[model samples]
Target: MAEALADKNRYAHAPRNADWTIDQDWASYTPEEHDRWNRLFARQARVLPGRACDAFLAAKQKLELSRAGIPDFAELSERLARLTGWRVVPVAGLIPDDAFFDHLANRRFPAGAFIRPERELDYLSEPDVFHDVFGHVPLLADPVYAEFLEAYGKGGQRALRRGQLHNLARLYWYTVEFGLLATPAGLRIFGAGILSSPGESVFSLEDSSPNRIAFDLERIMRTKYIISDYQQTYFVVESFEQLLAECYQDFGALYDDLRAQPDIEAHALCAGDRVLTQGDQHYFRARGMAAE
Candidate 1:
């Protein structure tokens, strides 16, 4: 039989062992672990100044993430609080949805406490400190994006009470994890998943194999996404304020409307879509992870 889910904590809860609590042994991280953080941080920083959303770059600068070693949570949180009301909380690994929601609702971002092992630089089965802190934290400094996150967390709780969390989580996945943005300069990345990964950074915009459709709030909630690999279809937002304003508008009614309608196919494009790049979907088809 499958193992039971991990225990729920003040940070998160999940029915499967996906929920994790923070128990960071700050001083115990090996030299190699700190090296990994430095390596990943430096590499991404070099690439992000131009590719990342302005808000993200700014937040990263404000937070003063270390290029020499893994950041101490206390130090990082202090910087974050001065810019936004957000604070970073350490976690052992994934947390229960409710616990995750509660943290976000309270403006506390739960970061996976552990860094990945030396061998798993390219990938890991779960989010590591790199993915959680590097991928997600910078955007938290953007006030508009920060508000959307808090709203998203509050929405998650309501969705859980309504037994519609699966659908709601999908919305978070597509927008927060794999989202893109449209700027006068062309397309750019704001999503944590794309922001952190070097391969996806190239694949998402420059590659000819993935679809880039304009952002639509309802459409995003209805669409499916690829979790374990690069996304095939990326929703594009015009601006940060647009995403927050559109998303924060009462989703209660939108949620009801979605339940009453059919879910959009994962790969299907609608007539209403504003096509930025109509990818061949070859990269995803050849390398996509099986749907979760």
Candidate 2:
């Protein structure tokens, strides 16, 4: 990580103060940054509708996102709060899990304040503003998904105290960041990380290289993940209601029980899985692990 990213000193929680105000250096967004947002936005808008879950597509439409430019946080927050009582807050990037949970518990989402440099377009190790706002924020407009995020935030704080933050984070990873869904249309992209990228949006749904299993909270928590590449397995939920209903159930016992089990393989599919696609592991196998 760069010094600018590692120095936690520059980082601050979004929804700065009780007024819920975010001071994004809107004018400071460079032409290249805006162009990146525009390019990403145009490409995704075209790819997402049919392949993305109804909630995701609906939320994206409700927000009126465009390829015109990067959105101002103020405008986005205003519109989102109206729809789901949730707001977007600007942050320096990758805060501790505690801070991340605190913001979400209060209906505030902390987005990275910076954009990726132009040279690293296809990928960047750390999240940039485009990934945070464009990738994640649109789905926050849906009431069910918004509520689920706030609940996860609250749940995270408790899990952190019990030394179960890892468990809670897996819940988030399997849902918020890299989750899948079985919609009336078929398997769809709901995870923002997949939703924002040109290549991933298509690959996650169309690729035969990754496993797509049904969402099982316990299974998700125990499942290990790959950090070096695209996911080897993606969990699919039936609906946002199914996801929220499952999470709202007390996880205390589940967490306690899971702590005793060995971590599941990243690509393993258990008997309970409502298997969507049994991936062939082509992507990861083709590229061996690389150094940071």
Candidate 3:
């Protein structure tokens, strides 16, 4: 009981409700905090126009996310709901996986209420208001992408029941966080993690250091990912509709098959992979994590 009480207190902000949501309290942000937001916004703004997906860019413009300062959830929600029936809700920080899946399942995006410190603007270890709102919120305005997310939310429980949540998590990580999209114009960014980071915005598309593989449900589930730094590989989707159709299914059979197969290392490519770029692996070699 004592430990449970202690864990609950760790939230430490925003007076959380049952859903683990807290008030954004837009008024509480300081001038310095808003300045950090603008700086982060400005960096991504310069890089995104040529790199980010047409769909994501269109939705971002439609939602008017380019304006100054941290967005007020109340105002952002009003605009987003009008477009796709989805709304952004503020969270104290990282909520439980169940709560996260539940929020997405119900069309509520649980964004971190606080902004990252000024010192860590270049790289924040956890998802902050900028990463959540700037990286993710715009895609929520796209109908096809938005529907895919909701479907992913609804399918979470079955994976949990099968004890294959890790596999399911890879789906989100590969697609939503680090995904790339192939366009007639060329490969464009869609994943929030890539779209938001100024450094990676160029690396994921132009650096030729990471494997850009075509999206495959089984392959992504079997593969590992990097969190602390850039991905050694990125999966590219043909379209949001293609991703939705691929994932919208009973995965019991897939789970059974995957349980018997070995997990792939983060940077390794398979013989069967539809490789777009084989990746020189120059970056990982410099770090001594990849050889051959």
Task: Using TM-score, give the best candidate's number.
Answer: 3
Runs off by more than 4 Å, candidate 2: 1-22, 289-292
The lDDT ranking, best first, is: 3, 2, 1
Candidate 1 lDDT over 77-119, as tens digits, reads 8888888889998886777889899999999999986777666
Clashing pairs in 2: none
TM-score of each candidate structure, all chains considered together? 0.89, 0.90, 0.95
TM-score order of candidates, top first: 3, 2, 1
Q: Which candidate number has the best lDDT?
A: 3
Per-structure clash totals for the candidates: 12, 0, 0
RMSD to the hidden true structure, all candidates: 4.5, 3.6, 3.2
Candidate 3: tens digits of C-alpha lDDT, residues 97-204: 888889999999999878777667788887888899999999999988899999899888778877899999999999999999999999999999998899999999
Q: Which stretches of candidate 1 lie over 4 Å from their true place?
A: 1-21, 287-292
Model 1 lDDT-worst window of ten:
1-10
